[model samples]
Target: MVDLNAALRPADAGSLQPTAARPPARLQIADVSLQYGGKTPTLAIDNVSLEVANNEFCVIVGPSGCGKSSLLYLVAGLTDVTSGTIRVDGRPVHEPGSDRGMVFQGYTLFPWLTVRSNVEFGPRRKGLPKAEYRAIADHFLEEVGLTAFADSYPAALSGGMKQRVAIARALANDPSALLMDEPFGALDSQTRTVMQKLLLRVWEHTQKTVLFVTHDIDEAILLGDRVVVMTARPGKIKAEVPVPFARPRSISLVLEPEFIALKKRILGLLHDEIDETH
Candidate 1:
């Protein structure tokens, strides 16, 4: 069994100073709820609250229709909440801002642009110089291992490759936090695994706070520092499980007994929620 103590110990203080010194951009969600209105008003999320610290990789998981993605969208300011508030570093989030970056399940690339241009889109919109934005795009393209495909259009890339570009484009904006909604759900299992590992590498290197939503428990366990489980529709926080396995993790870690045990615990929590709904 891996030593939980060692796994949970804080990263070296000296080595972490660079990221630590940056202004705090902790994500805070307080008493948040979302509803849709028409002839039939539907409550999708009910008083859900979550906080993701800067540089933390937090994943949300729940059974289908549990509003996991809805909660993320609320934080991204893509949709307004019916009640409560969300703040980043103490500033209220009223709408989408450059401070928050989003990546969706679909590769939302600009079909007309080459990979390089797509990645540079955000920086360019911010009025960055041509040379400066190009350099930023180049840096993230290399970070995502797509330097060779910089000139390729979205249609020319594979699904996994397209998602890599999506990731690069989001990072190029240098958002305070990254909000991803099932970014790899459409990929094959092998490709999904590769992308998961690639994301960990980039997260560690960039130290960006991430709030990712997925239905895959294994992906949650493999990638998150803490996995937030939500209950069935009108979703609420069911449990928060800390992933104590050390970082620099591999896919093989999933086969470990500890990993399996943790998976079972989370599954039971999800099952209980599903059972309640039925």
Candidate 2:
């Protein structure tokens, strides 16, 4: 382990370069909490903290009404955190900004706009030149395998296809973080599986930081680099599980014994949390 004399020789100026430490976390949620207002207020989330490394796929899984989506909204800057902070690259998140993109469970595409136009919407609003937005939309459409459908309206596309457009639209913005809230939860099992694989492909290609929320344990395990499990309503992080599987994962990997074991563990904890909520 000691080659200090050789290291000190450094004869080639072109070959020697200092290596810096890895950058700080790309997204950080520090002691965040939230509440819904009314005469009788409801606490939706409680003292949650988590981090996603740059270009990591981090999934949050929990039982129904666990406030997973609520936390996502806070990160997206669509809602305010009652306490603590949400930061991206060390900048505090206060309001919706172009730095983040969102894909939701429902297909949030504009029925009136064509697929390409829908993807172009964000850049257009930012007043980027037409050619630039056109290229941006086209590139992401191709990435999502939707290039051929670029001219079609949302009303004419299948649910899966429309969601693909939603993903493409989000990515077209070149956001630093991609926030997803059960984006495929509504699809049938078969379609959902296909969408999951497609999403992995796009994720590999783009390498953008992702924070995805899902109640599906299988879905969580299939995609996350690390899975953060939350307690039932008034949710707080109950556990954090790192998925040790290699990347470019496939649906078949779900059948592996190791995968099954991890799923069982997460499911056991999640089931306990659900029972506690009841």
Candidate 3:
């Protein structure tokens, strides 16, 4: 929690602003469903309701064919929901915009643009003055440890570095939320580990709300404030497990007795869900 007493502002100088002290559920999904063409008609998701509080690190994990990525798309408004509602900051999500920054697993950085240019893309599209772009882009790049290679092309960087640049680009605009769909799924094992550390550091430095979609159980447990496990197909949330560990956790946290116990429980929950789905 931010120390309100130490935070200075002109309004606080003279009067008190009446605001509820809650992280606030910035993203809310209620009885949502998605349908697509298939012989059996893939439901994608059904009756799924979730709320992500401000600053919460939420990870959605399930089996391979589950609708995790579909859920992210629905949140982004990249695809329309078949039913129910999606809201962010208490407003219904209707279309894609910079209010929510998204990082895809495929590393969508423009091959034509340099890393610096890629990071600046969002700010530039906003028509933010060039004077402001440098600092915003540079700041996030530095956070991702890409300041030295700001001018390097994405093709020239390692897989991990490329993903970091993508993250910096998403964060440069300082969006109210970050939506990620398995953003590190394409990397090598070592690179994925490094990227996970980078993601934690970035989340620490900039406490934007994150909703990450991953199929990896270990990854979900390692990063999520709350891990939402869903059923295999026609997905539905099966369990929501709070990590219960404090922030700045180490990789060794996985080996901790409590962490291991929770992991086993979550696995059993997911197993039951998977069987029901199949």
Candidate 4:
């Protein structure tokens, strides 16, 4: 069977391998509810409570408009919750800040900035000492394997490289949590696959808590420690299935009996919703 519990985790310096630490309580969504400008507020998300253990890679997947991204914006505090609470390390999330870094689908890197400059943007905003922030930027750029392109402008790199720069920028600040909103949704299959491997390696090294939102089931099953499925707008948790797969996962594994089993299981769970959406 696909081993779900073998997700990439933080590693120690002595060996470039995942080293377990006290589980980080990276993000908590406790009975949160929200909606847009509708007078009734439409209840876009209803009482969603989720716990992402420290450094865990949790993926939220569902059909389009299922409030997956809404849940992310709430956790990142880009929008306020109507009723419940969102806590990161026991503190309420009221507004956006550097503690949580966000990577959007579009490669939002400044076209005019060099790779180093883009990664350095956040720490520079924090007004740290020049040398310190520069070092931080250099480190993350290298971590994401973009060191050779440190001086290249966003316009010069391929789509995959641009995303790597974006990821480096987010990690430069060393945020405890990373929120990705369909970050790989636009890439061609080959580039997307390459980027996926790059991300797992980065996570293996950094161990940052990740809350990923995607509509792709294969991507979710391949990358997440646990997959949380949601229903359509006025979204509610439809299923919360822990991914039972092994790490260093690959496309080849998807054809395996265990991987096929989990895929069927999740698809079966979503069959009703998919049909209803038609």
Highest lDDT among the candidates is held by which one? 1
Q: Against the hidden true structure, what lDDT does model 2 obtain?
A: 0.86
Worst 10 residues of 2 by lDDT: 9-18
User: How would you order the candidates by lDDT, starting with the best?
Assistant: 1, 2, 3, 4
Pairs in steric clash, model 3: none
TM-score of 3: 0.89
lDDT of 1 by residue, 18-73 (tens): 24433344888888889999999999999877778889888898889999888888
User: What does candidate 3's lDDT look like per residue over 120-179, in tens digits?
Assistant: 999999899998998889898889998899888988998889889989999998888899
Least well predicted 10-residue stretch by lDDT in candidate 4: 8-17
CA shift of 96, model 1, Å:
0.8
Model 4: what TM-score? 0.88
Local lDDT at 60 for model 2: 92
Q: Compose the digit string of candidate 4's lDDT tens values, residues 93-186.
A: 9999888999999989899889999999999999999999999998998888888999989999988898999899998888889999999999
lDDT of each: 0.88, 0.86, 0.82, 0.81
Off by over 4 Å in 1: 2-25
* Order of the predicted models by TM-score, top scorer first: 1, 2, 3, 4
